[model samples]
Target: MENFKIDVDADGIALITFDVPGRSMNTLTSGVMAEIPQVVERIKTDDAIKGAVLTSGKASGFCAGADLGDMAGGMLAGGSLQEAYDAGWKLNGALRALETCGKPVAAAINGLALGGGLELTLACHYRVVGDSAKIQLGLPEIKVGLFPGGGGTQRLTRLIGVQAAMTAMTAGSSWRPNDAKGAGVVHEVVAAGTEVEAAKAWIKGGGKAVQPWDDKGFKQPGGGPYHPVGIQNFLVGNAMIRKQTYGNYPAATNLMKAVYEGIQVPMDAALRIETRYFIKTLMTPQAQAMIRSLFLSKQELDKGAVRPAGIPQSDPKKVTVIGAGMMGAGIAYVQALAGIETILIDRSQEDADKGKAHVEALLKKRLSRGQLTQEKYDALLASVTATTDYDLIKGSDLVIEAVFENREIKADVTKRAEAQLEGGAVFGSNTSTLPITGLAEASVRPEDFIGIHFFSPVDKMMLVEIILGEKTGEAAIAKSLDYVMKIKKTPIVVNDGRGFYTSRCFGTYVAEGLAMLEEGYAPALIDNLGRATGMPRGPLEMHDDVALDLSVKIAK
Candidate 1:
């Protein structure tokens, strides 16, 4: 009752709203899970309550998912493996009880429902989603090196087909309301403010207490795992999973095992099968490490934990990008998409126009996919100005130089852009290899200069490494972090070094592969081995993509 606000209407319809105290978003913590059974009992015991509607009181989303910090900590706590295994079963038992409690329950998903959040809804007899593109629903536990422990593997596969369920859980892809409804994850999609009412109406209209899977003579959606169709799917799916993961991710393999083995049994037995493998996955070190870095650490960094305290946040209204190359063009496009006035500069109008054309090409692709409206695309195009004039950069809050990676050329461009900027404006260099401190020597205000290293083909890569120069002030670093956050990209702060962070580690990987070639290792064998180890591309292929001719010139 503490985590949930319950009220029974005159019609005996109980609405339980989830709103975790002391947190901005709702997450299924140990306290929340303990409260769930009590709430379910309240709905069952109260004769006035005929049916129940579960929803969230938060504006942000329904729930962010299970509290990973609590779950991961308990799984890795100083206890026997049996202790951890027992902890996972508590939630599974509660969800199973809720599903079979003999009362019709409807889930009114107002916003994002992920992992345990989505799993809880699967127990409900009916689900209604709010019509918002920003609303995301999925079981993204795989990203944190965990599988769904709350009967998700069994229920999702039963609700949707095995192939669809496998893709959703493994890839951690979130779906919009319409997409989720079409995929059979939700029963209906309504306007943003009407999801709760829609769910209540379903309950009020006497929705079935019994789930389809719980009915007698029920069958799996795509046939059990041994059927001709299922056999082909499992064989092909298992091979593809192994190839994609290269056997490094124990979670993926175990997930496949759970799905294949569980589908052959009754609902109760299937849930037990999933729980066994889910516990097995929890015992692995991969889950602990991934939860620490990807979930816990990522949450801290995204909150600007590294940014200097007491410095006010900076929102750049007008930004300038110096260069018309691939990196610069991508930067301009993203900036414009964020609704910032972007000035893209090059040596001549022809070159600057080419950069603008790049933005147009990307915009048209989005438009064709219905991700963007033509009107919005035109507005974004109009926000970007392609020019050869550095004078136009005046009054800009931030100017990023994505020019050639030559010290002299970067220095020259830095000086030109700095001269045009107003006082106290921050400047960044999108250099992957060069140190930010060395590049700062070219600026009049070295304190305002910082490194904002973006990956190649910038629009697709989510990470943006922010390097703090030796002389870089807190203001510059703070503003750069703000800019990266504005673009909705993950930022990692590091001290200035040659190829700071990602690039340095990446260079070391390619260097080892090149050494193998010199030692007479077959190129094909080395490439195959690299990919077998789950590297996205072979080291040799990656180097060539970075331009081998450029590497030769750098060596000279």
Candidate 2:
């Protein structure tokens, strides 16, 4: 039942360790919060204690901020807005109390000090971090469409300069120990596995519990001289954020406002403003929808709701791809690279040979980039066996038809591949538009048919949408899930429908951009705006690269 422990040594140096029994990482949950006051009281009452160091028992650094699972549960239970507000207020108060404690405190940051974890460190008088690559520090609540509800906004701005904090908060970029130290976030960087010792040394060395900003009536360095420069930073940063997010995200902008406003006031006033903004941003429909789509829905889909529970998994060692076109070759290359024996079959030897060559070129590029060794490349190339023979697919655990978009052509390939494979072998179609149920009509065993839709340039795209038709059995879905995981790609399962969720939602972004262009908006402006919104590519540029023809094809 122990959530935290304070061990006071004879010399009056206390170590406040957060173990949080039954959890691998410490998260600021209600139970954990409830225990903090008692621990604080103990430290306050102990006359012998001169100073303390806070550290985590888990390898994952401090806490991972507030527990989203707990937050979602409370919100779902129809909790009042005031209740949520009070919860956040109480957590902030606890952190502030620690900061103002009579005894000095040091944070031993071992791993990731993120969100609430980083806020805790900011509250400490000094921080010493381990040089672990896994140790990332940041307040990335913006990724989930929320600001740091804790005192992260005010504390981060005070620790670093305003502009640096603005960039980090809005971009939601985590930093390594070196970078954190350079940004003035962490006071010292110690070697990995030695953070606790370093923290203890600092505390025993009589390090004062005074932050720089508090000690010297600190004015933000480079504020006036750099105020004009902030205009450019804000403009370019806004543009970049918009381009990446497609204006679909609001958290970035809200975070920008928080950093911008918080830096203008003293720490106390800044903290109040930050908390108010955090609550306001959290209640926005965009934030709630993002939380639902990016967190809740994504979690459910990743857990294999589309896969059947009782079906045994499929280890697809051998896969047959029945097309030599762009999509087909991409699939073949990915399969071969994953060490799966792949057969790239086409209507002619030349066609199949071209697909083989495409894979070779990709692997050679990887070798040249030092991403693959020559021996690995050779082995990967050897995994792909190309031919014009349909009979070569007989032993394949799965067959993916990647031929032309015509229904009859796809149906023919489906039937031909199904005839060659065993009854249990799954049949998949790499169709972007066709309904899975309709494609299943061509299969002898309709229950074995499903859609394994790969985005273009399959080797690069992280998402593989698995579509389950009405007649597709548990075994087919299960096998598909297993295969997708084996290839080291994220699987998002959706019920069979035209232009599944990503494609459907993505089309809206491109279409809107085009609509703006058609209304005499400059293509550059539209593109810049899209990039500023946080999309990887500008809409018009991506449209041209993907070809307007394909968008039309998918639309149909």
lDDT against true structure, model 2? 0.80
Residue runs of model 1 more than 4 Å from their true location after superposition: 361-379
Over 4 Å off in model 2, which ranges? Answer: 9-12, 72-84, 224-250, 309-423, 441-444, 456-462, 482-490, 505-541, 549-556
Per model, state how many residue pairs clash.
Answer: 0, 22
Candidate 1 displacement at residue 83 in angstroms: 1.9
lDDT of 1: 0.88
- For model 2, the run of ten residues with the poorest summed lDDT: 70-79
Report lDDT (CA) for all predictions: 0.88, 0.80
lDDT, candidate 2, 1-556, per-residue tens: 3888888887788888988788778888778777777777777788988888889988766888777767645533446777656665666777777777777889998778888888888888899998765678998888788888778877776666556777788777888888889988888998888887898898888888766656656766546224876455566767776655666676777776777677777666667677667766777888888788877766565656566677776688999999988888999988887889999999999999999999999998888755687898899999998899998998899998888777899988887888789878999988877889988888889898989999878889868888889898878888999888778777877887777777677777888999999999999899888877767788899899878888776666
Highest lDDT among the candidates is held by which one?
A: 1
Q: Which candidate ranks first by TM-score, i.e. highest?
A: 1
